[model samples]
Target: MPEPVVVDAMGGDHGPAETVGGAVLARREHGVPVVLVGRAGEIRAELARHGAVDEIDVVHAEEAVPMGERGTGGAASGASSLRVGCELLRQGAGSALVSAGSTGAVVSCAIRGVGRAPAVLRPALAIALPAVTGGATVLIDAGATSDPTPEMVAQFALLGASYARLVLGAADPSVGLLSIGAEPGKGNRLTRRVAELLPLLPLRFHGNVEGHDVLAGAVDVIVTDGFTGNVVLKNVEGAVRAVLTLVARSGTAAPEALREVARRYGPETHGGAVLLGLSGTVVVAHGSSRAATVARACAVAHDLAGGGVAARLRDHLTAEPVN
Candidate 1:
């Protein structure tokens, strides 16, 4: 049997409850192995609530990291469940780690515990969004590093391309630098420099793609700094929700059609973003995730770890010589 996926059971808004419930769902419905790390008593109580006591393993953790912790404070201090879960992953106690904790804390702890892959200046978060062109688009730096240098952004492009091919199965994926305009040298200084460097790398560079190009499938992989990428992600979610509401209110789309569209874009559909460029797999779900989202995250992490995403990315980066 494969090693279990480690979950920070007390890291999210409704953890121990939601996380533990999700673990039960993953085990019962998905047949995936999971180990929950947090306050053992609380986890048992929640599991008992679902009549699932002792069905999953619970690793004890004394403290919990606050959801409001964005900075380096208190995060690095002690044996928090987030850190313990990362340590479990680093020590090979689990195949992957899933957390809906603070994105910054998760990234920082994973980098410190699981470490970065070879030649990775900084780790990035990548997610595939359903596109208008039938397939999906891989968006990198979804919220991992907000102020990476130009060189780091270029590396994010490579990571995104690899993720497209490996996880999303986009054969020979083409990458685009997300920019203000769809022309060369058309973005801020960071994007301009990154645009210059991308073509020099060992991937198919698609020049610059404007905002609309993201969902148009103009390129398989879209790369940008975390700040902009995060904004784009939230904006896309809000825009989709608003558009669906308008369509339903106007009776322009059939009820089933609108339901299918909403299901495709739901957070439960994708589970979460994979923290790319790490030495191991870590899926960071939305902090406000529910049990369904948590279960999906565990399944996603198990599949990614089984596919050796982190090792494959490490080997790819090493062979490509990103310098």
Candidate 2:
């Protein structure tokens, strides 16, 4: 009964197979309305395989943005599934967009098509990663702006803090700058400069946090450039897998218990990283995502869109500005 979430069916590693199946799953299992945007024939065939051809709507697209594309090409092409899906969101034909396409391309297309919220210098990808304290740490610029200005990084902290408050329900969330050392004036020139600017802004700056503290729950929000944040995200996933595998082999924990822990941190459970500071909701999932991950991505988009998260986030940032 709600507006359908648009999915770029040809964007992921498994293409229409996983994406379309995910759309069907979101509609049938989660009761979320979905619209698949991709090649009409392939989408229908995949939907038919799930016996959902009649349930979900399909919008034909002539192209798909390649995984390597960095937004310009994806945004220029009117027929790419990424572009088409973004247009649907921009035009109000869809409530939100869920894509496993290149994060750069999705961010690029969303900005060009759906636009950014007023006064947003650059949009960011914020991911809520589980912490050891049972609360989540919101990592901003988690792959959206690999290289951003000092001011942009400062704003990322603002966005990350606001997200912690609105979504994670953290009151007065403490913010940390990701650095090599916990001391001030640590990390590269970018981080060093950011450290100097953080205290000047309206935030509960918690100084610097080292790599080991990312999951230590020392801070509610962690702000860094997209490149390092992406590396951190991948490293966390790999470490989780490796440690759990070793634990299973050691027989210290039950296999079922280990499986549950893995599932808790899996891509399917979290869906994907959200592109924040935009005018509309856009969720970018793993390029290698399968049906379950895609379905969860759609559900995430639905909830964020319905909750008026983008508007609320903009207001929050305005109330407590970075600059």
Model 1: per-residue lDDT, tens digit, 84-148? Answer: 88888767788888988877788777867776655677878898888898888998988888999
- How well is each residue in 1-323 modelled by candidate 2, as lDDT tens digits? 66899999998789999999999999889889999999999999999999888998999999978888878754547688888887887677888899998766887688677866555667788888888888888888887788898878888888787667766888899999999998896799999999998998778999999899888888899999989988888788889999998888887898888988887677424436788766567888888889998998888778777766445545433433322
**lDDT, model 1, position 238:** 81
The whole-model lDDT of each prediction reads 0.82, 0.82
Task: Report how far off residue 26 is in candidate 1 (Å).
Answer: 2.4
The superposed Cα distance between candidate 2 and the true structure at residue 107, in angstroms, equals: 3.3
TM-score for predicted model 1 compared with the true structure: 0.76
Q: What's the CA error at residue 322 for candidate 2, in Å?
A: 17
Kindly give the stretch of ten consecutive residues in candidate 2 with the minimal lDDT sum.
314-323
- Candidate 2 total steric clashes: 0
How many collisions per candidate? 0, 0
